[model samples]
Target: MQVTALYRHPIKSHGRECLDAVTLVTGQTIPWDRTWAVTHEASKADAAETAWVACHNFMIGTRTPALAGIWAKLDEVERRVTLTHQDLEELTFCPDDPEDVAEFLNWVAPLCPENRACPTGIVTAGTRGMTDSDYPSVSLMNVASHRAIEQAISGPLELERWRGNIWIDGAAEWEEFGWLGRDIQIGEATLRLREPIERCAHTSANPRTGQRDADTLGTLESDFGHQDFGIYAEVVNGGEIRIGDKAVLQ
Candidate 1:
């Protein structure tokens, strides 16, 4: 298999950024992936600790599918985030400032559904990522498997719905499931496929429209006999990875 694309999510449940190349580090997720999260007002996660908390404590595609419509761009040099959406004007702010954080909260409050918990604050991860998994891991997706799901659903689906960190082509459909507890080499990086990622309600949402238009979970369970579409891997050997890099099972 070959690496067809690379992506990073600077903030949890926010927009995705495509990359041509990136430096992977051992025991860490992709650069800046899920570095920050919008914590809900009713969350019980202690703000004082930098530990990984359940994704329910923060904004997520499952509860607020509209969040998928929000496009976020991070300026690493300035430590600022700029958010853009189809219905709202672009807003940029430094999340570190209390005043700026408040402005961001106000901007996002109206986008949330009434039944979901409202966002109260923006939180950052110090040395670790706030990824969905408790461990620092990167998500890997197989394009062939994605096509299978599309075929099963009898409709087209966007890759963004998967929110994967690495997308690979040329792999046989569902071949990744056999890779659990195995090592794969991509360019100079060696990663251990830890487990198959289970499907979630978020996958049903359309990334462009934020509408729950697809029954991704249902199709996976009924047609595929499973509720998984991707795999999570840990970077055991750090190295540079780029688009078009070959991925070989080790």
Candidate 2:
């Protein structure tokens, strides 16, 4: 197998950016992956309080599908994120500047219905209301797993549905399934495979159009024989990873 594709989500549940290649840094979060989120100031939900923003406290797939088509890229310096639609001009925004980030949030808020439900906003790294508990601020996936999912679905499955921070394609199909509790090398970076990522209603939500399909979960169970898919990994060593980078299972 070969590394076929790479991706990252700048804002949780907002949009995804495809990469020709990427570099993995040890102890450094993946570029633009969940670096920002929307949350609301008032809600009876378990963790609601503070300035309310849409993606901050909630998940994306269930309500917005076009989010799957959105893509992003981090400037080589890792200070700015550039947003893109499939064939549209890329819009660059700074994560460090609150004003700039807010502008971008307002720009895309209208694109999603969830944004309409509540006043939408953006939160970047170190911001008070972004991220989920246990999230390392970055996530990775194996291309092999994508292939397996595609085969099981018997159709073209878009990468945005997974919203992983990194994508590697040099391992056997579902090879990551064997990586639980192990360490693997991707390019110059070493990562510890933590555990199997559990599926949630989020998966059933189409990232491309924001429509929830009740069949997504059922399809995964019937075809893959398990509701589980993909492995979560933590960075063990910092380094740069590029497309076609050698991935060595240690």
Candidate 3:
């Protein structure tokens, strides 16, 4: 298989940006992936806490599908992010700035439903990125598996719903399931497959429309007999990975 695409979500459940290439670091997430996560009113975390934690403390795309409509591009040099959504005007500001934080919170308010927990704060837990898993991990997805899902659903679906960090093509459908604890090399990086990623309702939400139009979980259970779509991997050896880089199981 080859690397078909690369993506990173600077803010968890906020937006994803495409990358042509990136340098992977050992025991780290995709560069800037989930670096800034929004906390909700329902969270039980200490405001000052700064370490990788569970997903329940954060507001994510699974619960607020409308947030899926947000798209983002990060200015790494400026330490700022430019965000765009259909319902709101474009905004660009540094997330670490108090003034910008307040502006961003207000700007994103309409996208969040009134009935659900409102976004209350922005939090970061160092550089590991707030991946759902306890360990610093990257996600790998197979295009063939995604196609299988489309076949099962009998409809078109966006792969962005999966929010993967690295996407590979040319592998057989569900081939990744067999790679648990196996070593795979992509470009100059060597990653150890940790486990299959049991999915959530987040996959049901369309990234472009921010609508839950598909029963992804149902189709997975019925057709595949499992509610998994991807795999989590730890970067055992860090290196630069680019589009079309070969992925080989070793």
lDDT of each: 0.87, 0.61, 0.90
Give me the runs in candidate 2 sitting further than 4 Å from their true place.
41-56, 76-80, 85-92, 95-102, 114-119, 127-138, 201-215
Q: Candidate 1: where are CA atoms >4 Å away?
A: none
| Model 1 error, position 224 (Å) | 0.2
lDDT of 2 at 122: 51
Screening candidate 1 with a backbone cut-off below 3 angstroms (N, C-alpha, C), the clashing residue pairs are none
Query: Which candidate leads the pack in TM-score?
Result: 3
Question: Which candidate ranks first by lDDT, i.e. highest?
Answer: 3
Q: Candidate 2 on 152-181: residue-level lDDT in tens? A: 667766665766666777777767788777
Model 3 agreement with the true structure over 1-250: per-residue lDDT tens digits:
8999999999889988999999999999988999888888777654643787789898887888888878899998897999988878999988778789899999999888888888887888768799999999999999999999999899888878899999999899998998898999999999999999999998888788788889999999999898988999999999999999999999
Better of 2 and 3 by lDDT: 3
Measure candidate 2: CA RMSD.
4.7
Shift in Å, residue 174, candidate 2: 2.5
Error of 2 at 91 (Å): 5.0
Model 1 over residues 8-84: C-alpha lDDT tens digits? 88878977778899889999999888888888877766473357887889888888888887777789889788888
Sort order, lDDT high to low: 3, 1, 2
How high is the lDDT of residue 213 in model 2? 46
